[model samples]
Target: MIKFFRNIRQRLLTENKFSKYLIYAIGEIVLVVFGILIALQINTWNDERKAQKVEDNFFYDVLLDLKKDNANLNYYKKFHTKRITYLDTLLTYVRNPNKTMGIKKFGMYTEPLFYTVAPTSYETTFESAKSMGEFNNFKEKQLVKDLSQYYADFVQLENSFSSITRFVENQFEPLMYKLPEGYMSEDTGMLVINEEDVQEFYNKVASIKDNRKITYDYEIILKTPNTENYLIGDMGRSYTALGKIITRQEVLTKLERALNKTIKR
Candidate 1:
């Protein structure tokens, strides 16, 4: 093509058609400029396509993480609800001294409150996307906003959970150990007291004929009422926070499906 254009220019110059040669030269320059522009446009499209793939991968990982988070939150919901029930029963006995005998049947409802059952949120992928500005690949501003808000809320909830955990281990567990021979189970969080041990604690309480001993022994048996109150309040807050996280996880699940569908199309 270059040789053909060169021949034409030389022939035109030899024939002294200067005006025609000038027009041909301008036309050739225009074609070269147009070709360069088309090449650049194609390169830009290719780059965009690659970025879109990266965005899709990020969303896929995020969807998986959300699913895991939903499951974890559900498990926590059930676990904390069980703990609340145990706490409620024990508190009721504390409120009514007559019900304290029933506490023997309840087997000293001492759960391993110190055991942390924190939810697992796989947020590394999301954080990586944010730090690298991969979110820009997504066209929908609302999606980005929703993701940002969810992660921000997660941080707050996680911190609250950690604080509550520390409080339980440091303050509440020691108070629990002072109660009786029964102790908390390592695995199931249920208190484990031999029948003999239970009877012994009951016998000691029953034999306390002196009014002063009765009051002191009962107080000793339920030594952690204040600790329980703090735990109940904190655990309630934790439950509420977990519920919110579950709700957001469900919403994000839907969003993930929608985006995946749209991308596939």
Candidate 2:
């Protein structure tokens, strides 16, 4: 193609009809400029296509991460909810003058520790999106906003868990050791709970007028310097953190669905 254009230009110049040559010369320059412009446009289109591919891949990975995060959030939600329930049972057993402290009450307090450790979210995709500025590449502004909020919520969740951990290590666990030896047996690693006492504790707790409610007054709960209050406060913190995680998970689920639809298109 280059040789063909060059031949035409040479032939036109050889003819030397000066005015015609000038016109042809200008036309040749215009043609060369047009060719360059076309090449540039094609290159730009190719680059854009490559960028879109990269963005799509990021979206898919983000969806996967969100799915994992959602699963973790669900797991912890149920786990924390159960912990709260058990904490409530123990609290009821302690506050009621009629209910005696026994193995059952001890188990209620200790069982929550089985799931006290919070689960961490899958954040690799989110971190990559932030660090690589991939969020800027997204056309939808809501996606950017959702991702930013989701990660921020995760940070808050982590901070909340840290507070809970400090309380457990410094206050709650030490207080547990103060309980009577029969309540918690070190040798058997089981609270020597009587079935009748456990059932009676449950019945009394179940009979409370508002047994399901979580009291948020940490000061009132903590003022007595009782182990029950420390456990309640700790569980309350865990409950609040898990609530935030659930809310964030909902947002993440919406974002994931939106992304999934977008990538399919």
Model 2: pairs clashing at backbone N, Cα or C within 3 Å = 103-193
Q: Model 2: how far is 63 from its true place, Å? A: 1.2
Residue-pair clashes per candidate: 0, 1
Give lDDT tens digits, candidate 1, residues 1-265: 9999999999999999999999999999999999999999999999988877776677777777777777776666665565666667666666675655433434446543545555467788889888888777676567667767777777665765676677777766677566543321222223432212344444554454543322223345554467547656655755765566566667767767766674532
- Write down the TM-score of every candidate: 0.70, 0.73
TM-score of 1: 0.70
lDDT of each: 0.64, 0.66
Winning model by TM-score: 2
Candidate 1 wrongly placed segments (more than 4 Å): 95-108, 133-138, 182-235, 254-258, 261-265
lDDT of 2 by residue, 146-198 (tens): 77777776777777767777777787666655443232222222332221234
